[model samples]
Target: MSSLISTPIAPTSHTLLKPNRNTLLRGDSLLPKRLSCTRTRSSSTTRALLSTTKESVLKDFHERRALKIISGLQNLNKENVASVVTAADKGGATHVDIACDPDLVKLATSLTSLPVCVSSVDPAAFSAAVEAGALMVEIGNYDSFYEMGIVFSPEQILNLTKETKRILPSMTLSVTVPHTLSLPDQIKLAEQLEQEGVDIIQTEGGKGSSPSKPGVLGLIEKATPTLAAAYAISRAVKIPVMCSSGLSAVTAPMAITAGASGVGVGSAVNKLNDGVAMIAEVRSIADSLSLSTGRHIVSEKNTLRL
Candidate 1:
């Protein structure tokens, strides 16, 4: 049986703009007040329907200690795909994230039952990834885009999510809240993604010409933006928020403490020469996260199906 499972369709495109930059608050800020009012005013019947579905939906992937491993950008090479799956399986990674390439998805799905998440900037590429057996999809995993003078603005990222949702409404969707934004902008985009029915919200750090650092200091620096975003978004949205990009074992638990439901570590594991070492690293990170959060890492038997 496959690890990937499909859930019911989420809401269609619904955009709510926060008070724009330079807009006067007039009184105590109204965004949160208004959102709370909306939730409060939602008919009891509607709330009950949502509660029923949310109860069935697993939002605590992190509380369950599911550490998702995103194979390194370098691992997108066709030759490294098998090793990526091997590492993910041995390390107890819930899924692997790959580039939106058909061959990679086919190879990854064939190699493991774990869900495969494909990343790309193009709508066509994301659509292809979903069709090619990717159980989930991500946009704005565009380190390369930043290098080429392309920045993923809030408008662009939200538009991508809207377009992707229109194409694959039933697929699990995780939208990256661009790290390029200031802390406030990141929070707003995250909430927007949540309103647009994003199943997951991911945040990253600096991009393009940015030196990739690993271990403690690097993890802390890289995690700063995503961690802030996670802290803000987790409370703002009902969906899960994941911290990604420059994360490591040391900071994995920190991320959880900062309100992340889970984490997506890319270069930390996939950059290793030996798959076993990579797996071991992932396991250590997962173990650290489990200990810090006081949550038991779900055994394979205990891993609840969505």
Candidate 2:
């Protein structure tokens, strides 16, 4: 009887109160608006930085004397990579190409302000490297693979280019036309790549050449295939053409004269065991390009005067 003192306690109001629509709307309007503004500013800043970087990276190419020093796509030796980067920086190179690794990009950026380009055949691998500060990504430099008897077909290269563009639509992309193909096929591939929005086409033929002689004549013989590819593909496409492989101080300027907007030198500079020699090689190539560009400008001016 004592426990039944159920004087009907007024039914406790157990109903949970819901937030008012107006109150919820006001709450959402506050912090979210500030976050949106912040995101917009950050996006705008990133775009501006990218534009400036691209402009600076392409400055020398537009001037038709871009000297890109490559350290090899498979060369991961940090010490060698560092030496190559240092040589390129000190040798007045406009760009540097290294393997597609975020750490390598960081290392190169730390060593020099030159636009660092990462090389990879895997399209997916470029994202992290680009995020790490690589201003350009290349899809060729297949010499090491060629040594292993591996080669990329035209369809394979096209698909890779498509995928890369999908992933990094705004990035500067350079694709190489495989030297295994006939020269006509190379020009065809170059035209196809240009149609796919490729910013540059790089020609390679060093792995295919076995010079039969020595000295300057041998150098010319070594560079003939790539120079031919450059001359043909440059005429077939509207974008910049980078003539690479088996080139030296003797033939780098010849590449520019063959309608290449730029020249990429690798073994000539990277093969040297001495860093001083590496730097000297890069300087020689750079000087050769400068002299070639100067002569071209003078020739144009004289033509105008005439």
Candidate 3:
């Protein structure tokens, strides 16, 4: 009788231990499920935060009077970059664009409150700059490349836009339609980019124009291609069109009149050797945009009264 009781008791103890092991395994499996849920929620929260940031940064664009000052896509000089950024901030410009460098982004951000935009042809390069504090990324800036006889086709630009959107879906993206393309193709590309979720379509034509006259008429002639592009693309798509390249205070308001939501001045401000001159140029463009906006408002009011 004692042997029988002992053997059964040992077997019962083994059964109890086996159930405890199974219970531990089940709890461990549930931990992974809980962790996955936590990760998903964290990702959702992060996307929401980025979306909010994008909206706040683009407020000026939504107002149809954004003045962007470009520090040149190829410009890597920190001193020059600092001067341009300071000019944009003090000169009443709404945004500043610089080369896509993390260090430069940090420098620009440190110098001004205006939203810093980083320009790069490499889609992979934009992430670090954005992480460093850039609020926007531009894919065009094809002027330097054009000088090298390099040009981007419509397919290439579209692919770049798609890749950039894939990499940073929540960040504000501005795609510049190459001035090398015909006006119809430019419009087509702009429409496609808007479908791809691009926030802004920038038109560039500085390199293509050869102004015969050397003054204000020359400026208008220089801006003609970009202005036409802005007008066509703005009407073609609901997205904002930014007229860039070969733009100055004289032609900046003309850009607004021609249907551009904003203007981007690069060589006009970046080409100046003096910081005060850069600021003055930016202020001139900003004042032009301001006056244009004022005139537009009054025109609308008067029309309403009529």
Candidate 4:
């Protein structure tokens, strides 16, 4: 890696963060009045940007404790999508990750002031979502593809990043490093992604993992793959690493401890049957991420200029 792109974070030892009380609140409770984006479709694209000054997604990634709630890339039901988006913002999530569909992006934007991110493996899918008010775009979670025995090669991942950038160069781009790759290869891919102009790198596990232990130990065992990848890859790339998949409130702090700037949770929130349950789960993850990440935060913010 060139010196300009060699800025990687060194993982540090950090204690597990204690869980906070689960205080569920209505979506309206966060503000005296609800916040809505009144901009028309044409103007929304102008306001939705990859970065902002004070509370930009970039700043949150720099802070290293941001929590992202995933509503599934395949989930398209209007009611279910709305419920998940409401729960994510009300539960204190830094952002909500949803399917890269124009309709879903519009629905998410109509509901909250929090940054709305859309995800997909196809680069063509992002254009409509961006026009619909999506502020962030992500490629490849790959967790859903495991059941179909589909795996992405490093070359495919790099191409996806390139194509997505070609479509929306200014959009905050996040690409997931397939957990299927060896740790060293994962790191190499991350470094290349930085060179490709991806703003963030996300790591995933759980679909391909089967935990042998039970209870709390089982949860840790389940999260081990992604957490380990985050430790290795975050140390090899200048961009912020978002540790995701198979993570719960119990292991979220472990991700930040491993040098990830944030955690992306999917099934933990989306799998819940009710909106209230989803809100509670989101809060729990936020609680786990309350640890002091002072050292890693300082290192990343200074080394990263993208």
Best by TM-score: 3
Provide the TM-score for each candidate, comma-separated: 0.72, 0.82, 0.83, 0.78
Pick the lDDT winner: 2
How many residue pairs clash in model 2? 0
User: What's the residue-level lDDT of 206 in candidate 3?
Assistant: 83
Candidate rank order under TM-score:
3, 2, 4, 1
What overall lDDT goes with each candidate model? 0.69, 0.86, 0.85, 0.80
Q: Write the residue-wise lDDT of candidate 4 on 94-188 in tens digits.
A: 88999989988989999888888999887777777877888888987666666666788888778778877766667788999988888888889
The alpha-carbon RMSD values of the candidates against the true structure, listed in the order shown, are: 13.0, 17.1, 17.4, 15.9
Candidate 3's clash total is 0
Q: For candidate 3, lDDT tens digit of each residue in 41-94?
A: 886998898889888778778888899999989999999999999999988888
lDDT of 1 by residue, 177-246 (tens): 8676777888888888888988888878734214367555665776676677778878888888887777
Candidates 2 and 3 compared by lDDT, better number:
2
Residue 298's C-alpha lDDT in candidate 1? 42
Give the clashing residue pairs of candidate 4, or none: none
Candidate 4, residue 97: CA error in Å?
Answer: 0.4
Please say which candidate is ahead in lDDT: 2 or 4. Answer: 2
